[model samples]
Target chain A: MPETIRDPADPRLDPYARMRERDLVGRSGRFVAEGEVTLRLLLGPRARFRAESVLLAPERWPGLAGALAACPAPPPVYLADKAVMSAVTGFPIHRGVLAVGLRGAEPEPGALVPPPPAPVLVLGLAGLTNHDNVGAAFRNAAAFGADAVLLDGPSCDPLYRKSIRVSAGAALIQPFARLGPGRDWLALAETLGLETLALSPGGAGGLDGPDLPTRALLILGTEGPGLEAGLLARARALRIAMAPGFDSLNVATAAGIALHALARAQGRLVPRGPNRGGG
Target chain B: MPETIRDPADPRLDPYARMRERDLVGRSGRFVAEGEVTLRLLLGPRARFRAESVLLAPERWPGLAGALAACPAPPPVYLADKAVMSAVTGFPIHRGVLAVGLRGAEPEPGALVPPPPAPVLVLGLAGLTNHDNVGAAFRNAAAFGADAVLLDGPSCDPLYRKSIRVSAGAALIQPFARLGPGRDWLALAETLGLETLALSPGGAGGLDGPDLPTRALLILGTEGPGLEAGLLARARALRIAMAPGFDSLNVATAAGIALHALARAQGRLVPRGPNRGGG
Candidate 1:
């Protein structure tokens, strides 16, 4: 139900501020979402919420609350002035809305692979601390119908507020998992029967190599370092076809272009099937 | 040219910290490039610059300052311990290197557009405060061989630190201009005889519209509340051919895909021309 909150010190709005503190959020297992648009976008079918809360301006309550009222949501909606909202969130959120939803449950990696095997763009991010790049990768992964995204060692938290917003809520829909670094992750994927294709700008072969495999994993590393030498040596390396003067594409853009190439190679992104467009 | 700096409060490093304050950067006409990778990338032919100062680890001086020493670089490099370097820039300066370069003068809008006949994807962004998206747009613009990028209204500063890094220093090379919002900007574009294409999920025809003019301007808005209605109405609206269940692609990824489509339409990004492998 909707509730008006006059005092900024209200206990119900505690989760909003708690998310900023690493220790508190880690213990509580909560994340924050700012603005009505992302909140609305995340409220689609198949959305599984663990905890959902909204801090809204008075003018925004009617329509926003009504939308929730029509749904099966029993989450709390805290109404407050813009200043109070800013005080609680630690920033001026002009989006007029915020929601703290539970992180969704992910399926086993085995289930994500398409039948008869379509090429998968596996973004192998190691030490990629920037939340925006993480989010942009998820958005790109979803746009090009990547089979799944596997996070390698020391990457930034994908559920971080900035990542979610930067990803435009794509993280909520795209399936991803932390597959820690080293030989074990590669071993597990090999066991699953997926060929690994690591992206290297200096690699001998272009990304559009001959005899496109139906089931392959495209691995990517962090921004500057490119790819880990150990991992690059283990997996088959590929390079993007580009003009000479250009050095390299941004990791996320390269990921998008790679996804497009692999999807087209496997005929996965072709406009067909259900009237509903490709996700 | 590179010197060791033991004191964290060294007065010479003020310009580095000054770049941190977003407001002061615009007023001072200065910006900082962190890491040896980006700083070197920014030192290319198209990137004109006069180094105001540089901060680097003492050990990196010999290897990193080679090209700078040959030129008439007035700004001496300031060396500091890892801890002191971390304190200067809000985030950890991973490569133990940083450089403060003057903001090079931007060319006039008319000068950026190639003299007719060629395909140009001029990204007109409005209300996109996220620096990463701006950077990603620059990255994509460069990847697609866009003639130039034009900014209007209140958009994020391209010179912002995060944007420069996210763009992989492409912001240093791509030509851009800040034109205020009005009919004049559009009129000037029309005078150049460039067909303007506004990207919207709900825009009229799909992304692969018939025979798009070779020279065109692709206007992209922030994630939600897409291109302003007035702007969309005024330009040719186009939507990407997306699958069902998918709402929209991240603005940058969408730009990459659309640019790929547009380049394909214009026959620019084909596997030919100067891209012949191996010298």
Candidate 2:
């Protein structure tokens, strides 16, 4: 059933109001999608689950009504006037639609990638605090055949509107989990028999010459401050070869190049299901 | 000269206050940065100019006074009480210091890339609204041998605090300019006699090929919509050779891989300087 909301102070909008209070729907365990395009993409067959609730600017999207009827289990769709919506969201609702969902249980680290022909790129959350990096990390993780992404230390939530938007919904599709701090992540990768290759430009060896194993965990830190020194000491620091007169690429971009090279070296391509869009 | 700010409501903080008001600040060309490390990087040798003003917390650092003394045109550093500093910034100023700088001038479209003995990897601004992508593009531009960068319409400013921080301060160092709609950036590339290659997975030609140019503009768009159909129609689409199984890498990561591969093909090595702190 669709409910029309006329008042900004309505009690039914507690979840939506809470979302406004926190600047996002979920504080730690929830993800939110804004805009009809992103919502459509998330609700598409490729996503893991249906949205918990859909908030819409009634006047902006006249066509959304038919679309909602088509969903297998149409979640609650909240319709509000643009001004009231803006008043609650604290900003003009540009997208006119927002979808909220739970942060599903993350797959166990080893479960993301098997010890086979495919190499898994494990992005280590080093000193990166930017939400965009975290989102881009997920995007790169999906692109480079990383089995899953792990995060540590004040990293942005993948489900955050900004991160999801930045990742182009790649964060929603990519397999990711938080492994907490360095010690915990290192031990898990070791137990999984993954060759942990830490990416650092200061490393003694370049990425190409490394004697990496088939099941490699390519650990990367945020830019500027690469891997934590202790983390670097624990993992093998390797450099990605660059063009003459270039310094270093962004961390996510670096990961992409490394992943592409490694994937080519392994001679395998990742396959997206039927829902894989144009690419 | 440095000033001590004991009150949060001091009128001097008016300019800095715009940082939080996204719409106003986005319209006005201004951004903010905090922390000594970020300030130091932003103030490196290649940095064009000093920030407008700085808000600092007292007694946090005894040694920083010497560094401030060395600036050619030192900024207005305000030593504020912790509570007062937090009140003005609308967030806890953890860096013990906050610096506000006027966004620099945008570069002319053609001026972005330098005359190349070095190859230029130009990141196309096609419907990329995410600030992170803008930031990542700068990071990639610096990592690759791109002499300059160009920004198109509806794209976020490279100097936005999010972008500046995301690019690891590369946005300041890299030569970047902006272009308005209908200017036809692809046409400009053609006029510049530079090979224009748009990164698209749909392209028939693989990225690692014999015909790769020594000097090229590697353009990329936002994730979903990909490249604008009009622009893509004009520019030749080039796909990065990926493992058969993967769908596609994140736009930034793809650029990274392309930059690495193309740089190698062009016989470029990563430029090294005193500032190559890739930890």
Candidate 3:
């Protein structure tokens, strides 16, 4: 059952207030999940993060009742009319579903990487400041069965609301960790015994070759000035072949292509089960 | 010589006025091209569209002078300060570059598809209304050396400003044509003599198999609700291999992966020359 809240200023709804402004800053130890798909993922059985609470428009209650009921210890549900919900959030709650998710303690980078001989595929992001790219990277990583995503210090937070929405909620379920600022990600990959492949337009060769190692870290950087010179120098450099005189694909799109190709080449992709979604 | 404009309401600047509102509707057989990269592409030698005029912040002039000068019978250039430019466009022109491009006559779908015996890769988009996705598809198609992009009637216009910017100017240079509303794109593909492969979550098999034909049309639909059943039934259905329960990749990302793979499979991708951009 949902507690009906009439006032926008209710202290209980503080977490959902001024969302547009709050999105630019930290949510303390929490993050907001928006839309039905993402909220469902947060409350679903496979969720890695725990939901603190859920806010919903009255009309959304019926559709979400089952998922809410399925939670082991369901979070409190607050129901509001569209006007009050919009007033509280400082924007129209078009999807009519939102949840507050707890971030918990950060996972150690090494723990996210599986032990050797396990056919590992990890996506490493560097200097990716765009939330959309970070989210899309996580989505691609999960879609291709990459064990985890490791982000360098300069990358944007995948938990950002827009990213979570863009990722199709993969950021909530995918295993990920971030390296400390200025930390040597390459040295860490070396210590983990994972072959490092950096993607660049000027990479040594195309991505289709069979030489891709079974256990590898595919590093992606921001769109324009790609990975740093020192990082590209140490890792095996790979390029996606392109027509003459064109710029590269958007960074996230490139990550998707690289992850799919490398995952296929290494035989890491899982065969589609009959009951699963078709993509 | 560039004409200096002090007033935002000047009739000569009408094509650039109230850009945000005008973007929602058609531009009277014209399109807005934004950002330095796209402007350069519009004025470049290979551009498929012609520029009617260019508006620039004073600071952007020195850098773009060469490209502007190179245009045969170069379009008139309007110079304005950031303040006047922002007022005219109804938003801050952060990139400080804007141009009005003529759409020209719509090319026939058959004309855009290369005649038989040429290695053809045509991206067929269905019901993709998202400007960003449409733009990204064009960028991916251009990057992977797809001969052209064919859009069904339900798809959005690719010449929208945001689409043009997202396409990295591929929308200006890439050969593209749209089928009339309610037209069957698969029938057109059949007429073009290209094998049709539609991407879906429930696709018959994964995209990795070697059976993909050299000359093919890869069809992509919107992210959710994928391609319509009638269309999917008419074409060979294919899916990107994914982790068992994950949702499909974003349509644009899927297109990038598919285009890269099929282009490589068909030997249509051009090798990186010594001097081209590295992406």
- Against the true two-chain complex, what DockQ does each candidate achieve? 0.23, 0.30, 0.55
Tell me the tens digit of each residue's lDDT in model 2 across A83-126: 87777767787768877777767666667666654555566665
Model 1 chain B scores worst on lDDT over the 10 consecutive residues at B270-279
lDDT of 3 by residue, B1-279 (tens): 899999999999999999888987754788999989899889998799999999999999999999998999799999999899999889987878999988889998898877888888999998899999999999998898888898888788889988998899999988999887766867788799999998887776676787887789889988877887878788888877777668558999889888887888888766553532333
Over B23-120, each residue of candidate 1 has an lDDT whose tens digit, in order, gives: 44463578777666677766545665666777887777788667565555446768897778878665566688787778767677778887777656
Clashing pairs in 1: A207-A239, A276-B244, A277-B243, A277-B244, A278-B243, A278-B244, B5-B79
Write the candidate numbers in order of decreasing TM-score. 3, 1, 2
- Best of the candidates, DockQ: 3
Best candidate, TM-score:
3
State in Å the error of residue A105, model 3: 0.6
Candidate 2 lDDT: 0.68
For each of the candidates, give the backbone clash count.
7, 17, 5
List per-candidate RMSD values in Å. Answer: 5.1, 5.4, 1.8
lDDT of 2 by residue, B1-279 (tens): 568877777898776653566534474555676667557655556564457877777875465776676677777778887788778767666667677776657557776665656565565666678876687777776776566677778787777777877676777676777776677776778766678887777765676568888768777787767876666667677776654433556666666677666766776665332323445
